[model samples]
Target chain A: MAPTTQTPPSLRPSPATLAITRIVLIAAAVLFLAPVYWLIVSSTKSNPDLISSNGLLFAGNNIVENYTALMSWTQGNFWRWVGNSMLYSTVAGVLGTLVSVSAGYALAKFRMPGKAGIQLAILGGLLMPIALLTVPLYIFFNGLGLTNTIWAVIIPSCVSPFGVFLGRMFVDAGVPDELLEASRLDGSGEVRTFFTLVLRLLAPAMVTIFLFIFVATWNNFLLPLMMLNSAELKPVTLGLYGMMSYFSPQYGAVLQGALLSVIPLVVLFFVLQRYWQSGLTAGAVKG
Target chain B: MSTLTRPTAPERLVTEQRAQANRRRRRREGRIGWGFFAPFAILFVLTFVIPILVSIRSSFFTEKAAGDSLYGGGGMVETFAFLDNYAQVLGNATFWEGMGRVLLFGAFQIPVMLGGALILALLLDSFIVRRVAFFRLSYFLPYAIPGVIAALVWTYIFSPGLSPINQTLGSISEWLTGLLGNNVDLTIDFFAPGTIIASMATMTTWTFMGYNMLIFLAALQAIPHDLYEAARLDGAGEFDIVRRIKVPMVGQATLLAVLLSIIGTVQLFNEPTVLAAVNPWMGNDYTPMMLAYSSMMGTTSPSGAGPASAVSISMAVIAGILAAIFALVQKRSTR
Candidate 1:
């Protein structure tokens, strides 16, 4: 059998079949990246060049112009949106990872009261289709005067039941109980053991959960749309969205902004690609 | 699981004292475990339980104005309305139509995307291509792209004047028109309301197919290597091995992919919303989620929070039911 997610070979094939499969795979990959290619090409053009130039070819070196223009659209508000997005996604990633890791470790490894109930709650949460909660959460947050505040977006995002589930699974598979027992025997506390040994063991799962939450918070539009009204509080997703009404005229700058906004995540994905792949497969293998 | 000890418990100690000590340790461990779990539990309750309880509670009630005009009321009053919200949501045709549109959209998109993903996984796992890592990474790269950027780029690409698809087809259509001695319009306007769902589906599939492939690929890799050797020893062909071994082994992952796709796509917002942002023809009620949003967002209306909450609840219930049914069918089929 093939190693599931890994690319190491399995079955031998005839030359014809190999050639056909290779062609098909290459064609598919090119087709997949075609839009991103279009965006990259288009982002370098000014508005006039965008109209005149070939859709898939660079027209001029207008990257700086487009970047500055997009940033200056609302008096450098684009920078604020990017900063807000980074802050929310990063903070949410850290907080979500911490809660998920600890909760997962506890549920997976500890002798505890109400474990099943907590499990049930998280499972129930998994079914709730989190986006639906935005309206009610908006209501509650508004009642508490949290609307138009940063907490409106970050607070609701702080918990991801799926992360909790994955974390539990990770703890069960990755961490050995014997090691915890040894730590206790060596006079290490639960907090110390978790921070020292369990944290190291769960690095992959931590990255997995962090990336998931980070992308989610970065990608989120509705929560911010509902909770936030001020321009300064907007994350990049909603900020670009708010700028899209005049999209046809500002198409170049808007496209540039969108692509630039997404680059951080792409870079993050590249850096953490190895761990996330393994962590994800761990879920599959264990399941 | 025995702990290494500096010294054994004194034999002179009474059994009760030792038992009590053991109980205290277990209790202390329980406290620590509870401590570890405290943050999630509190957050889950605040963000999950309270929202759910209050939403459900609020669904049975609505806010009414104190006067004849909804706007003129000095103070809005919250009143028990029984299942009025649920009934209204059920009676709302546009909302149901939006629901139907999303369901119909998912019906075709989910299967085709998953099929593509599975095939890609199988091909990658088989190593028919030498650059397995390169191809895998290429397919998976789109997963990192934000859905908004994907939608915007695709929307731009699919728009009539900006679209290369139209330009390419325009040339072809001119040739066909000349060949046929009449006008032959092969150029497609991909942003029209009629084709918005298909456009949405394309962007969605483009963004997600790789993610699904990763899931399937991961499952494909987990199949035991011994099983393939045994099948080969029994004279099974490559095709036979894939069908009889690889596909069967990854059924759980397939089910998972399907379920996740269902849950995720059922709440479809970003693509349609982005498309609608440019193409107003798609309207605010393009999907159930959109309808829920649009309901709460009018200047003259009384916030429409009641109706919006109802729609949100309805979408959640429908998605839950679909997911449950899918899980059950998979369970049954596997058994």
Candidate 2:
């Protein structure tokens, strides 16, 4: 690490190379940020301004009116949708993280039977796209009388096979077996040893797992759409989709609402950008 | 007092025995492992396994609606329609056309998406790029937005009345129409059938390019830095470094992304579904999954729950087969 850290001093590029690299970087940045820029600009504009003005340019005067009209557009249903999204994301994120972390710890630390079966199941779940399961999940939930509630959203999310799989790999690699044995020898109970001692060391992995689950659950649409019938219970994705259906004639308002719905996700991404990157990279490599 | 303090071997043995019993108790406490995995097992089986079985069963049986109210009354599930639904799906020209469209979409999309991602990843990994963290995060921002929201945002951009491009084209069209009076060109309509794939592709590329880019970038970062230094010393250019080193190193990541993209492409639902709501041309049955949904729950008439299930099962099977083939190929290549 020390030797590699010193190599950056000698690594310098010529002016021509720097110019080309800068152009590439700037272009890439623009390509990525164009939709977001459109989103922000469209959000502040009213129906007329959205139609007339340049999408990329800012004529940021309609912010207040847009917010007011958006709030009242569906009789205060938008805020209710936001609340439902929060409830679903928060519950699913926390529970999913817990299940993943604990199961990971067990699989990493123990000599339990059927570990292979569980691990293979997780792999299968990871490989199987959630779309294939959505219909089946709906039918299953319907049979069990679990459809149309926050529990239906939260329940299926709790078994994120990818999370558990990633968490297990993180634990096995990051937390040493000797340390666990030492904790056991010191007369600490397994759960206590895990939560109080091992958890501190597992912070990075935990953060990564939490952010991934949070983002995934926040972006979840199919399951929620299939399960929830009540508009009030719909998460923001389903809610936004419903609004888009009605906003066919009012393209400007649809754009504004679409942009509004993304604010939370943008905030989340910015806050956890580092964790998200490292976690994603790690998962890809291991995968 | 000294004699009492110097006590016995039996006392030490008794304490040692107690400690062993305590160790035994700790060993027994391992059953709490079940407590951890119990919830996962129950939910996994209930949600994933059972539904798949039910779907498979439903795929074979034809639901004959006997009563006046087709839904409320007696619907019978009968024996094997032996490849009938598959035959229908194959014979149904719309299903084949949708499949062809997605194939074209996949062809156009996979290359553009993967290419853009590869370029971005390579550039970001270069030493010349400033603020590596900022570049990485910015590129990945689109994926953070919900698919539904992403589609909605793109829809607004593509809207005829509000779109900037539409206005630009409208002005050009007005000039041309004035010059050539009453013989106006029809190319101004942005959602024309010829252009719908491009529209949908643009939206999809925006949403997922960053995600794939990040995966590639991560793979790029994992490559040994010394490889680049070695190439530079050998007078290799930047392009050479990317071509020879970065791409080869991240082959597995690329392969994984391909498999994932293919699976997602087959399940194409949200983009077309949302777009169809806006434009009549991009109808409800714009894709196979959409076809299934419309068949099962269309406002027209509820026809063929059995066939819908069959189509769905067929999709699942094809996806499964492709996934298996990819997995097998990946395993072999990696080995």
Candidate 3:
């Protein structure tokens, strides 16, 4: 690995090279940030301003009015959709993290029957796109009268094979076998030791997995679009998409809704940036 | 402690007891291991395995009547129509056209996006750049936004009424016409059928370029500094070092990103679906996943679950095959 802590004085680029590099990077940054700039700027504008004014330019200070109108646009249904999204994402994240982490830890630290088969299954599930399962899942949930309910989304989402794969990798990297042996020697049962000792050690992985699942469930559109028919049960993605589909002059509301849906996640990303970065790097580099 | 110094008989007895306890512990650990695996295993089977089985089974059986269910009910019975749905889905021109469109989109978008990401990553990894952290975060920020929101934001940006792009192009076209004294139209309608794929590609590249960049960046970060020093001692330039050292070192990461993009391209749904709202030409069935979705819901066709299963299964097969081929190629290259 590159010695990131210290750089040799001799290896530093010339002043002109550094200046050129900075210029290029700044240009790239502007390109990346343009849409985000537009999203925030356009959300604050009125409908006429949005249509007539430059998209890159901020036109009016209608943030409060636009947000209020967005919240009250569908008879206070936007907030309900937000709440539903929170509930589903939270439940699925927590439950899915638990299931995946435990399974991953076991697969990493223990010897069990049919372990190879189980590992293969995890790999298969990870590779299989969720789109293939959506149709039958809809039918299965519909048959059980579970469609239009939060469980339809939450139940299927909780079975994240990628989460399990990541959990296993995290366990292998973070947890030591000697520690497990010590815990076992101290008469700690497997479940008890996991809760008191292993869980703490795996906290970073748990947080990453939780946030990953949370964001996935929050951003999910197709599953909820297919599973839930009622507006009350809709997540912000589907709800906002529905709003945008209409020809009504609710572009401002839709933009506000889009901004509102993104804020929590962006906040989460900033706050938990370290864990997310590690998790992502682990997946890409280690796996 | 005494057993260590004790006579053979007592030491033997203690050793036997310890061995028995070890056996007991091993048994218990095995039981607990299965217990730990149970929840995920059950859910995995229920959600993934069962649905796949159901999809495969239904793919072979067409609905004989309108009200027929996969599960026998409603006084409706399904006939064994083996390979019929598969034949329909495979033979369908629209399916092939959609597949071709997606392949073309993937072919154009993946290289540009991944290549752009690689360049950015390489540039950031260079010693010339400072504040690498800020640049990385800025690039990655777009990925945090939901695909739906990303699509929606871009939809506004692509709109002729609100878009700087269209307005700029319109003026440029007028300028060209005036300068040449000939009628020339440089303005391109992004929503038009001929250009929608490129528009969609732009949105996708915007959403995912950062993500792929981060992967490449991570891979680049793992390269040893000694190699760069050696290359520098040999008087290699930055581009030479990147081509000879950094890119070769990050081959696996690049392959992983490409494979992931391949899967993602096949499951292209959200952007096109959202864009279809504004661009009537880019209909719901513009992509394979969308076709499968519309077919599954009977939104675009009356074929019901059988054809939908076939479409989905076909998509899954194609994805599986592409992934397998990539993996095989990667393996061979690494060897």
Candidate 4:
């Protein structure tokens, strides 16, 4: 909701209170941005310069060196990890969005037996803490001889019940019953109707769901840690963590890698703020 | 006799036609619905249901070191050890200690974070704050940063060698010592075991406070403007308006945020796990999830899976119980 342009005269806050609010807000913003500021600043400095100089201020002109060294570290494996992360998240996001949205549309529009039970199960799955699933999933994948492969990460991530829940809400809100009925009355098959009629209306919801799933999979560390082993298969998070364990002397490289890992998501987040915000509130309110 | 008991022939014919058409449509709808639902159902079963079942089943079994199997020189055998792993997990001091630590963390962190979020949301929703969009984005920027990176960034800030925080504290302590003419260590050791929890809590707050604030803001926006207008007309002050109207109006959302926080706190892993790399006090068994992870990874036990399953199941139970309790309380309050 947009804020009203003009406040009623009677409801206007006093100048002193307004000033205090502004000051508090600005202080909080600075506190929130402080670490990010430090991150960006430190990524530009050399390891020695990082320790010797003021951390809050810009000091060294070693951005190129730091990034070059970061890229070349670990036999240039950082770039590979970034590639693997991008692949896994993208595949999972697209495929998961498709499955969840289709199911959600069906559940919302079609009359089916056991519909209530299915919806309830989705809700329960949403509430279940995924951290608890890591161990069993590891065991399961280990049994399947799939633990070290990217499939182990992508497969489980593709089944987000929250996405399904969001999909149902989006469909219910975005798609009208009359449109589906009209398509059906025209003798269009269920699949065709969905593809031709409902899919366009569902684009915004799809983007929202896709972005959410992408971010979740992109940020996922525990699953990859539990499932993958080879250095080449590691995502950015686990890759950075592995580096952090032994790269104490080269804090510059680690900071650079961390900053690099965060930059893509931050850019995407700002670009898709509207969809992401609505998606977040949608789940919280409905689920 | 049949004709007398039944409806007229025309009516009977119409009823039969309608029933037949309805059945055909119902069957078609069912087919399409099931067809569409198949993919998700199959994957959900494979990933979620199967793992949960396997965990539940394995939680009741204990791994025994068996002699050479047909294909292997040594193999671990799982025997039906009902309640044994559960007993071990429940009886372990470290497990309870981790649980206690998390409970304490939640108790302190939830209030401060949620309270801060509520206040911020109120301030933004009020007429006093301008440039709401920029402020909202700035506040929520941390949430976009992954938990792993967030921890890493904060580790830089907490590092004594690299942190501006420590540098600032160092000068402040030095100034204090000079003024008092006595040696006083006033600088905060963020990595110290005693302060690690608070430090971690602060990081957690930093990451989640804005996210929660957005939820509260959404709820606040949903409140009808007329209610606020009415309150203002009745000579209600800003504090009174917030207290009397906004808070109660957002009760459901507040409860939802609280419940989600409870579930989230119970499963706290990523932040502490990342921070443990920099801080020695945060051991492998720092939280229940970590303990379970360490156990599952065979760091804590020779037969790790059984005990790890028990630990995970226990965590799930605790989360479910807490969620149920919150739901009950919220229902009661509403009633």
Candidate 5:
């Protein structure tokens, strides 16, 4: 049988069908890009312009003001949130990727006892709903006195079983066994071989894993909402959420803040778009 | 065959044996690949596995009020509650109501979202769509934007006071007011309670459809080309081929997407919570996750942590049971 998600390639489309497909595809693209367009346009407009002008179209002469307002809105606190998000996502991304890559290598290449069990454990981890664990995680953090700290968010995020699972699959399929054997014959240590030979082969998968974890950790909400309280320690997600809760009526400021928060992510996505798509699927194959 | 010849041969044999031993040592060292996985194993046990065990245990305890204390207090000491929290959760009218809504949302939203994704995926996979990568990235870009930001963006789009939808209505009303030469209004309000569910659905589908599409597309691409050639030789129509071949081929991915949707809908919080902030009618307990959040964080539950814990444990159990039931049904059907 053909793969379900693929197109039925046998049916020759009439000219009308072809035209309709193009239109629909264009429409979908427009729909997808519309919100982003609105974000940028709104961010550029002044408070009054934002309130009065067409939200979908560009208005002149308010970009500087919006930047200043966003920067100064919380007594110069927006950057703090940005920094916090960066610190959390960066640390979690690197460590999570490392763990995933190495773990995946072992699971894919090694003949350790309990390998099947570990693989099953990773599957269970993926299926376990975040909501189910949120409350328990909170209480656990409370016991550790790690609540309201960046580590609470960073540390927990580092243990992504899915990442490790992805790392293992990529290494298994992408890296060659012969290369490792050659390196071993040269008398290099296993660690050195991995760092030198296996890592070079697994670079694409690693980048993909890093981007996935970074986006997840950066955009994460409920965990940070449950964990951190001090604004300085708040990642952008939590900071924006807190602002939404406290300043529900300040549309202009909130709008501006929301726009600012999304820019970096959007830029990151565009830069690393290919990795996310390919990496996500490869990780998802077993499921 | 003299004594000198015997000594040289013995020395050569010793050298050969040492080289052989070194080779064996190297092979063992290289083969013991567990070194690479050590960090992940330690972390997985510490953060992921251990916390789950802790959660199961903590679910049994009742928290004390007036401080950050749980258990060991008057009227708050946790005992062998023995499914009491689960009982309370199942019995709680509000909890069930929230769960029912989630179920309803799941039933309707999953198909719509997946169908939309499938259509898009199929369309993209076809030779008709040009700039394929661009469209793919565009569709998937929203998933990249954090949930909080997605929620925020939708919040603006749906907000009555500031939304373009409402603003356009107001503009039309003003135009009517001028044309009629009388004080008349022609705007239709969308913030009504009845339409809020649809509003939330629109937001979620936008955020997730692309993600589902990517998975479906990947699965689609993995299918071999000869299947299509064979179908063509049989003169199967496009729609027929889709129903018979493509759908079945992507069945595993479709099932996974459904499972994920079910779980996600049950824990629906971010969208509704953000909406509630902008729209007063949504209130604190609009969704079960919201209810749990309020119980734990809101002022009414100064001692609400325990009840919140109870509510969450119940929710988890329900999710578990439902998942089990689903897996069973799927297994039977496949068999």
Candidate 6:
């Protein structure tokens, strides 16, 4: 570690290379962000200005009008869809995170038979793409009289095998054997210890898993497209797709809807990104 | 206690009691462990496992009509279909075409996306790029945006009349043409049937490049600094260290990402489905996933349950095979 601190002068990339790297990175950033920047700018323009005006710059301050149009155009269905999105994402994300994390903690700490089999089943589910099962799920839900209901979306989403895997990784890494033993030795009941120590230890991982599941459920399209037939029940992604798929979409309104849909996600990302980024990297490598 | 190298009878009894208590404790803990695991287990089985089983079963059994011919039937009778659904799917040109397009899309796309991600990750890790936070934020911003919205925005951006992309490209090419004294036709239509794959690839690359980059970056960042020192001491240069140590270290991660991407790409629906709104010629069976979905939607035939399941089963099988092959190769290479 001491020798590496010096980082041999030869190991240092030349100034020319650094400049080149900077230039390349900046160029890539500009290109990469063009569409995203366009989305923000273009959503604020009138339909005519959107096409005729310079694509990079905003011509008119039409964000309010576009938003108004979106509200009126969808008959406030967009707001309902957004609500539904929040509902589904939050419920499933929170539920699945709690369940999986607890299961993971138990698996990590307890002496349980068939834990290996359960883990393998989870792995098998991960390998088999869930998107491919949407059709059959649609039929299955139909049989259970759950189709077009929130359950159709929420129930399936409540089991993220990946989240379980991550939770286990976090438990094994974060919660030491000695700590649990000490807690037990202190006469802390199993449930009490779990709530006080294990839950506290697993907080970051739980949040990470929740956010992952939230984003996944929020962005989910295929499952909803299959099961959701009612317009009022549609999540934002499905709602937006419906708007776009119409014969003649109201471009201005749809743009506003799209913009509205991503705002919360983006803000959440910015706020919690640092917390999850480290957790995620650790889990990604270890898992 | 004093003579023999063995415990007395009381000690043995005490040990037996301890073992029994341990067993009881383990049994209690095991019950609690299962209690914790039960929700995920039940939900997983109800959703994932059951769906696969149902699909397989439905694929193998066809609904038998009353009078054996009439459209109107009595109570539903399901007869053993055997390979009838498989035969239907395999013989269908549309399904094959969709399969072909998906394979073709993945063949080119998986490499380029993963390669771009690898390069970006390496660049970020190299410490040459300034404002790493800014790049990380910008690149990862797309991931936060829902796929439907991203595709919608990209679709608008890809629109012929309204597309900033083509408008920008035309000007760039004109400048290039003037500089090089040659014709440069960089104005390719994204919605055109021929270049639709390119557009899809670009959109996918846009959405995932940063994501995969972060994953690769995680792997790269995990490399021990001492390993770098050791390599340098052995006269390994920057490129050698990067290639031999860094790349190989991240090889498992890259393979994992590739496998995940393979699973993802084959199940491509959102982008292409949206794009088909512009170009209708991609047809109902745009990709194998589309074929399965389209059949289930029953746009062509009424209740294409059997065939949709067949396509679903076939796709899962094909993907399983491809994933297995990739896993085998990676294992062999790593070994």
Candidate that scores best on DockQ? 4
lDDT for each residue of candidate 3 in B1-335, tens digit (9 for 90 to 100): 66467758867888899999999988887888889999998998778887778878888888764354665455555778999999999999888989998899999999999999998998988766667889988998988998988999888788877776776777788999999999888766778888889999999999889888888888888787788878988998777888889998888788878888898899889999999988777777899889988987878873677899899999888988988888898889778
Measured against the true structure, the TM-scores of the candidates, in listed sequence, are 0.93, 0.87, 0.92, 0.96, 0.87, 0.94
lDDT of model number 1: 0.82
Ranking by TM-score: 4, 6, 1, 3, 5, 2
Query: Per-residue lDDT for B1-335 in model 1, tens only?
Result: 23344334654355668899999989987999899989998988788788777777777778877788858568887888888888888887877888888888999999989999999988888844566778888898888877776787888888767786787788899999999999999898787667878989999999989888888888888777788779887988888999989988988778777887898877898898899888877778778788877776752122466777777888888898999999998899878
Q: Name the better of 1 and 4 by lDDT.
A: 4
**Candidate 6: stretches off by over 4 Å:** A1-8, A185-187, B1-15, B64-69, B74-76, B171-186
Which pairs of residues collide in model 2? none
Worst 10 residues of 3 chain B by lDDT: B65-74
> Chain A structural similarity (TM-score) per candidate?
0.90, 0.90, 0.93, 0.96, 0.90, 0.92
Docking class of 1: medium
Task: Write down the RMSD of all candidates, one decimal each.
Answer: 4.6, 6.1, 4.0, 2.3, 6.0, 2.7
In model 5, chain B matches the true chain B with a TM-score of: 0.78
What lDDT tens digits, residue by residue, belong to model 3 across residues A10-44? 66678787788788889989999988888888889
Q: Order of candidates by lDDT, top first?
A: 4, 3, 6, 1, 5, 2
Q: Write the per-residue lDDT of candidate 2 for residues B54-90, one digit (tens) a residue.
A: 7777666665655668573675546577677667776
**Candidate 6 at residue B295, lDDT?**
82
* Candidate 6 per-residue C-alpha lDDT over B235-331 given as tens digits, one digit per residue, 9 for 90 to 100: 9887898899989988878888888888988888888988887678877679888888888887754246777888888988888989999999889
Writing each residue's lDDT as its tens digit, candidate 1 over A163-216 gives 888899889889998999999899998789999999999987798899889988
Model 4 per-residue lDDT tens digits across residues A98-202? 999999988888899999899889888888888888899988788889899989999998998988888889999999999888888999988898888888999
Model 1: colliding residue pairs: A3-B221, A4-B217, A4-B220, A4-B221
Which whole-number lDDT from 0 to 100 does residue B318 have in model 5? 74
For TM-score, the strongest prediction is 4
Docking class of 4: medium
- lDDT winner: 4
Tens digits of lDDT, candidate 2, A1-287:
11323545445667787898788888878977877887777777777777777767877477777766666665588878877888888888888887788888777776566778887888878877677677666666776898887888888877788788878888888888788889989999877987887678888888888887877888887778778899788888888788778753345555667777778878988887788877778866876
